[model samples]
Target: MFFTRKAFPVQFNEHLPLNTLIENIVFTVFDTETTGFQVASTDRLIEVAAVTVKGCQVQSSDTFRLYVNPERQISQEITELTTITNEQVAGAPFALEAIEQFFDFVQRNETSCLVGHYVAFDVLVLKNELKRSKFHLKKLQHIDTLDLIGFLAPSFDMRDLEKYAQAFGTRIYPRHQALGDALTTAYLFVELLGHLKDRGYSTWGDLLQVTNSPARHLSF
Candidate 1:
């Protein structure tokens, strides 16, 4: 299926710290289970979800979830995993365009920051995509729950997604869909927040240095 590219405006935001943002800023619990791991050539985002949070509370009304037409064919394995076939997204809006629109929406409508599991991957893919589309990442403070999970539970040996679902006691619904995974990620993050608070740290800065993924420093 052929897709027509739509032009979108780029936004540059001030450096709003996530710790400070968490108190007053809303939280967009964001996640993307993409078509593939790589963000460059052969890989593109197939689905994306953002759950809105105010004062750390999830608000269903202020959420965004979409299945994007990647403007290309999803592989057999990916299609089976996500249950999103080429035909399903053939006429849908492009993924990049959807993200651009989502960015504008979030920047304008919500007073939130972003939270994601293995968030560096999301950030990396987003920055790379923006660069490809000639956009800037004014760079808001983003919280990475993968790092949080590890920092919070250092002894926990987690190698798979099921492990997280088991450890956090959060249900992983809908398997490969973006919103389902994001919702689970949000639940896991909330659990992590409780862990941090129990440890006498209520601010993000107190945990930022210790909660970053080891690979995140390599690129993010």
Candidate 2:
């Protein structure tokens, strides 16, 4: 279905690690779940969710969620992990349609850059599909949360979300929903942003350098 276009609220980015380009800034935090991890072979994306975050707040009204019909059946093993079954997605909208909508929503509302935990892998999956569709999905400015958290809390222990959540005094919820994970990541990202501001990391480039590599931990 060809969408006619709709206006969405502006997302946020002025406070990000970027320099002085503050006008028309926004950011989109997104996540997706598929039949499996490998986007290259048989696995395909089944669900995708995203939210616009501005001023360190998730705009609940400006969220997107969709389930797509995976041409192949989802394995029971994968289903157990994500709680998504092949029947749930059967006859749903096509992958192209869901992605097209997500692409447009993000392009219209998003700024700054796309971000998420383990964002690199997710970006790879979307980029590959967008390339195949010849869609105009932006190769985000790139922010891998695992790297960011490492940079800020060099002394903080535990890399997994469960451990991190305990460190932050919150319980991980909904386990594996895309939107649920995105919400959790959003909270963590804002905390990192605050930490950066406190430490004087005031440019996008400055923040990006640390996150571009693996998270570094301090000994002792």
- Among these predictions, the greatest TM-score belongs to 1
Tens digit per residue, CA lDDT, model 2, 1-220: 7643232223333345356422224567788888887786667888888887776666767888888887899999978988888888997887778877876787777456777777766665665555445543422365666777778777865767656765765435576778877777766676677677778775656666667653211101
lDDT of each: 0.68, 0.67
> After superposition on all CA atoms, how large is the RMSD of candidate 2?
7.4
Name the candidate that leads on lDDT.
1
Q: Using Cα atoms with residue i matched to residue i, what is each candidate's TM-score against the true structure?
A: 0.81, 0.78
Which window of 10 residues has the lowest lDDT sum in candidate 2? 5-14
